[model samples]
Target: MKHVLAIGAALVLAAGVANAEEECLEVGSPVGAFYVADVTGPSAGTKLCYRCKFKDRPVVSIFAREVNDQVAGLVKQVDGVVGQNQDQKMAAFVVLLTDEPESAEGQLKTVAEKHGIQNTPLTTFDGVAGPASYKLPKDADVTVMMWVDGQLKVNESLKFGELSDSKVSAVLGDTEKILN
Candidate 1:
């Protein structure tokens, strides 16, 4: 009985330590911030930052090469759900990964407009390094990271051409639980 109790206590301590080590962006990771035209906000430009902004609200950040119809739909649904839950403080952002971000803005804007996901903040980041900084797989085309109170809550990835309806719903459900 004594040995069993000791082992249980050790396991509990290890779990606590593991959770403590898991932060949204580890110290020294690139800030990965950029300014972009607002699709919904009244402001002309909004500076989206992984480190500075969304301090208090739970942030669902989608890192993708393009905001396709499926991705936009998922974000729209999650945004609506979060909007309905007044008790939950949350924000959604799409970080487009591209080599030529300036040129890609028009395309991203069009995609957002087409899918009616204008409410979500959309911008572009330089390379895979941005997503990798958050520990996403190098080959991942889209990675969703949800953070609450500066802690890492969810880090999910979907390969290029792999964003299915079921996967999107699962991710949103996970985010909902975290916000709750």
Candidate 2:
């Protein structure tokens, strides 16, 4: 009876450990690739793969279908985070996932100018596949994703008017922890 009880307890402990291991994998699944024009860069019209652009630094990506106050605030918030952490190798990308990406270019440029976003890049992709590659939902107004050292560290989906400073800070803090 003692032997059977010990074996049963060990099996339960092993199961717990296995579940914990799988939890990490579930969050860090690989993202697909897509290309976009870097509207804010010196070579403004040049196109590049979204993933390859920020593979080296910790990336904060905000995927929004439309630019609302929430999206603007979140982008500015993340731009500040990246600014403060410039020495730590950080980057932010605002990905506008719209049907008519070209038409939104002027508006995105205006938003970037308004926010004085120096650290983050403001841009848009061609199709829905861009956000889909990041595993973002269609209805979600903003999805904030962070990747550090080529690993997807944080993936947060926020609705309009839902982002707060504390939440953005926590994500930045968590990614910083990964670096250390």
| Leading candidate by TM-score | 2
Any runs in candidate 1 off by more than 4 Å, and if so which?
Answer: 1-46
- Per-residue accuracy of model 2 over 1-180 as CA lDDT, tens digit each: 999999999999999888655433234766556778778855478887757866757777777878876678778877888888878878778888877878888998888898787777888887754544465655567777777766777777766756667766665566663354
Task: Give the local distance difference test score of model 2.
Answer: 0.73
TM-score: model 2 vs. ground truth:
0.76
Query: Candidate 2: where is the Cα deviation over 4 Å?
Result: 1-26, 129-131, 169-174
CA lDDT of 68 in candidate 1? 71
CA lDDT of each prediction against the hidden true structure: 0.66, 0.73
TM-score of 1: 0.70
Error of 2 at 47 (Å): 1.1
